[model samples]
Target chain A: MVQPGSIVGGLLGFLGKLGASVYFLGEILRQSGIGIARPRLVVEQIHNAGVLSLVIIMTSGLFVGMVLGLQGVDALSRLRQEDILGASVALVLLKELGPVVTALLFAGRAGTALASEIGLMRATDQLSAMEVMAIDPVRRIVAPRFLGGAISLPLLTGVFNVVGILGAWFIGVYVLGVDNGAFWSQMQEYVDPEDIWEGIFKSAAFGVAASLIAVFEGYNAVPTAEGVGLATTRTVVTTSIVILMLDYVITAALL
Target chain B: MDNLIEIKNLHFKRADRPIFAGLDLDIPRGKVTAIMGPSGTGKTTLLRMITGQLRAGQGSVRIADGDGMTDIGTLDRDAIYRLRRRMGMLFQNSALLTDLDVFENVAFPLREITDLPDRLIRPIVLMKLEAVGLRGAAGLMPSELSGGMGRRVAMARALVMDPELLLYDEPFSGLDPISLGVILRLIRETNDVLGLTSIVVSHDVEEIARLADYCYVIAEGRAIAHGPPAELARSESDLVRQFMAGAADGPVPFHYPAGDFARDLAGD
Candidate 1:
């Protein structure tokens, strides 16, 4: 039967897990510093996490931008401010949707993959083997993946922002009869560099959070098939919640 | 007795379940010491404690380098990692890195621990692979290799560091008779040629008896018998005799405890 005591105990256990995650993050950062010694390793991780993620980011950004253009034209036309479609698209994509969506997709894509890979490594005893060989598996294995994800997400967000802007331009100017002069002039005036930078910064934070969670969950998984599966699930769910929460907190803190 | 590693009154547990209580054992220098016992007797746990992978609950798990002895149970993480560099361990599953090929897997420790160039690393990797008779399989990924080949590759990786001590956890399991003979021979040959201390944790009594110079048999958290393999073969302890003889029925119970089957089925 459920009891108040059991509820309190469960909450305390979750808090303990949170504390452990913080410690694990600290260890990852420490190992990442050692990864600097082997710059090639970090580079390799970046290629996998950042470079491979570009395609989806670009595609999604373009489509989202186009949708924003269509919606802005419809919504603002009633207010007779249809010309501001470019400005609306630019502002929302740069300040909010682009980074958040990219990070969410990345969490689903790269984060789960990272967790599963590391979890499998633990189950197979490869991590133990590395420890026995006196090679810090954290430094050699995790640091690279962590650094890679951190570096990957922001760049992916950047590509998303650019491609998204181009898509908005196509729809707002050529496809529709919106005035190109108004579209260009209004966006140029209203969209500040700082707005774009906010998205970039938020996405970078998301990347670190996502990557760290993925690696930690994998590395500390229970060394079983079910444990690996659970870690992968947790990586996606936890990373999405973290990215969304960080987006809000960062926006509040910075803006 | 020139012991390379020693454990004194060691205590370790799995949560509330005690695996070792005041356990003491020694690994002699430049010789093969075997710890043989029934399944779940903590033979592998003893190896992990020596390697500093698992912490002992209490007491000393010490290893001697040329400079001095380091108590594994008390040493900090960095110190333990530094100490581990001077040793090698062969895990039961071979534990070859799935991402890397046989050559890269074997060369991994050397690359991480030393700043040796690829030119130098290549030759050393090849030599170690040749030692294990897996030189031709260097390019094969771990998944592509057979079980015995994986074991050989892992063995090559273990010796690549030229460690002061080599700890083998069930090196003989999951191998055919021929492969088992080959591995047993390789272990003895490698230890003698490299002049390294070795410990093999396994229940394969016949192979261990043929390979191990000194043997210790543990049961239910303590050593039941220990001596030279010849003396251990002639042990007076009933526990030792039953273990060494591989008897089906002994002091060790065959069935796990449960309620009476007839009463349970009737749901009384």
Candidate 2:
């Protein structure tokens, strides 16, 4: 007895939920004023959600840069233009990998944690308890996390790009024996500041999308053990998908 | 006696089922009123409506918060928060924040709702904990404490604001006999000492009959009966008779409604 009407209704329900989530994000931004009231909570969340993601971002970034250098040297050496190894690696990371990959990692690491924390709070009645105690859970609990993510993503991407460049430099100059002058000049000449700024904007936008999705899932999660688990999983999956889709759209528009 | 809370023609539903319909109830000022019912009988919903956590479909829930009776059914978010300061509710399972130690758990309301310094906040938290006979357990984290200790700390937290109306939602649900007795005594003593109106929602007949000054028995979203505790126990209503006597057979069915069990199992 599955009606076509029911299918349409389900779609409407989903759209309604999307609208509500966007409204919730607006509230988060409005209440905290970008964490102006409670800088301490913002800093704590940055330490938890943003700063903690650093080690992995840097490690992955370095390895990816090295792999790109090795592969670029292999291919370009065959063409006898291997002197531009640094240019290839830097262009690849700056234009695409730096923001996109860091965002995906951020989604998995910080996003799931934020959702589960809020979901558990709901299950334990802490949010209702806060409400009854005259405290706004949004202002007290959610706003800071949003601010942390927004501030941290650009900084994290910067670290990733820096470490990645260094790793590529090692492979290009010392390991592969590409001319040092050629590699440096090629990287500086090809990779513009605009390219780096594009990556920053993209990662910062991804931070907003990911953190908002995480908190929204947690705040509205069904109050149970299974519910919290599902919410956490949804935070990672949904944020990752949104990041990838946004990456494509941003690349299309910017480039 | 003045009525502290007044409900008029409450209508509420959940999960496509009616829970409360055209119901009216009242809470007397400075006296304990017990809302007794079987599980899933909307007692908690009533508490939620009173707190403005749950809205009514077609009625008003009014609470006397000093200046006048504010219609909680229609108060906005900020207004509700201000009104909440005059009320305290002790939830089942304590709901103590796990991140904070016992002292901070109790002191949380004061810390968040006011700008009091740590020096002044510390003694008030300790004093409230002393009231609940848990002053020594202040340093213990929520997980480190026993169930009774946790419940006591929650009670301390609920009372730290010196609220006018206190609500307890099955406060003794998981307690052992000793803990239950301690909680019962604490509720009675604290209600009297603080001169606060209190509501206790429970189906534990014997203990509630001892603890409550007045009682209301509800079933299927209707008030089956209500009176002084002793009088309520002697009610002639069929549900009351069965409930008070703890009889196995009653209007409240022992089994859920469904098709023939054997036939369904055999897929006949």
Candidate 3:
């Protein structure tokens, strides 16, 4: 049996990190007031966090949609509803898979990059250099990167949803012999505007959470090679867990 | 001599290990003051305190701001930043922003602090780079520069603001002999020509001897010796002698303190 003392220790450690993360968020919000005034910095990070992750995100979306298409055809053929495969694929992409998978892939690619880059900066004293130069590192560095990731994820989720629907379309209508008209029409009838909005809202929230964790881990990293590696690992782990938890909560409430 | 900085009864600790205890030192205006110590003796920490990067747990650090001495610990964040604007620090790693090229790195402070037109800012940045003898390397990225070149670019960045106080942390460490000679000359020339006070944290006794007007050698949480480099070179203190002469062993032991070496080796 697990010891009670160990359980309490784990709980306390988690709570400590949670508290520190909240304080970090407050600092980012405060600094972002200044950071937003400098559009160029935020735009540069958008390219780092959003634009660079395009290949992996699109590739993963296509494969995931193709898999879903295969499964939906096999399952729906028993009920003679394979014609509605497009509706199932679109609804899944927008309501669940689109935002969820995009965020997971983002944590793997962009989140680790943000964490390691800033962690390396800290290790090499770039952040301290800024402080000595009278530049607030949070305002000048962290906030812009945070804002960039927060802006990019939702947009990436939109792209993922579109690509995923098209992937399913190719497989279901062309390869599997489902009627193309029935496939698209069924999707238009079933997938509501509310479903699309739900995906958008979820993606936005996950973006903020992922960006916050990455920056917080990086900013507070122990200034060593080993420490930076750990922070990068923690960024991906914490972001993936938070995205899943947030997805569940948002889905329950919206449904 | 008019002092540019004063530390009074300063006390600081890192996780129960006392880094500075009742330490006091002064930096004279318009001179290069070298801080010398063995590794891990908090030379860099002292510089951090002077810049308000790290606060003392007790006592005060007062830096001359205009005509008044502002107690660094008493100031708010905005006030500290205002004080820091008049200061510049060259980190041990050179700390050039990797994303920017040489010209932009030198131009960073000016662009951030002032809305100077590009036409005006360009000349000022080029002039500082020219002073550091890197005017032609302006377009190169930081990765393209040699170690000496990187340090020179960082020095130009430090001087671009025309700061009242400049701090160099281990400026001579890992430099080739030619780079060391260039930095030694720059430190002296920069202080004299610009009328700026400099506090250099280094263990390079030869370079400090050539560049500093006065020097402080700190150890065991306090300044153990302070005098002109010539005076320190002639000191009787065993620890100071060990440090100045670059001896391998003396008052600062060569071996780590431990139980019997034989017993430890035998896993007893």
Fnat, model by model in order, equals 1.00, 0.63, 0.80
**In angstroms, how far off is A43's CA in candidate 1?**
1.2
Per-residue C-alpha lDDT of model 2 across residues B1-268, encoded as one tens digit per residue = 5899988878888987999877778899989999998889899889988887889888888988676887898899878888888888888878888889998899888987888999999999999998989898899999998788788898899999989888898988878899999999999999999999999999899999899998888887777788998997778888998888788778987878889999999999
> Top TM-score: which candidate number?
3
Which pairs clash (backbone N, Cα, C closer than 3 Å) in model 3? none
In candidate 2, what fraction of native interface contacts survive? 0.63
Query: TM-scores, in order shown?
Result: 0.96, 0.96, 0.97
lDDT of 3 by residue, B116-138 (tens): 99999999999999999999999
TM-score of chain B of 3: 0.98
Task: Indicate the worst ten consecutive residues by lDDT in candidate 1 chain A.
Answer: A29-38
lDDT of 1 at B251: 82
Error of 2 at A168 (Å): 1.8
| lDDT per residue as tens, model 3, A1-255 | 999999999999999999999999998998897655788999999999999999998998888888888898999999999989999999999989999999999999999999999999999898998998888899888999999999999999998988888888888888998899999999999989998899999999999999999999999899999999999999999999999999999999988
TM-score of candidate 1 relative to the true fold: 0.96
Residue A41 shift from truth in candidate 1, angstroms: 1.0
Query: Distance (Å) between predicted and true CA of A182, model 1?
Result: 1.7
- If candidate 2 were superposed on the true structure by all CA atoms, what would the RMSD be? 1.9
Q: Across residues A1-255, which tens digit of lDDT does each residue of candidate 2 receive?
A: 999999999999979978999999889877886477557889999999878999999999899888887888899999999878888888888778998888888888888889999999999988888877777889888899888877888788888888988888788788988899998898888889998788888988888898899899999999999999999999988888889999999999997
Q: Which portions of model 1 show Cα errors greater than 4 Å?
A: A1-3
Interface root-mean-square deviation of model 2 in angstroms is 0.9
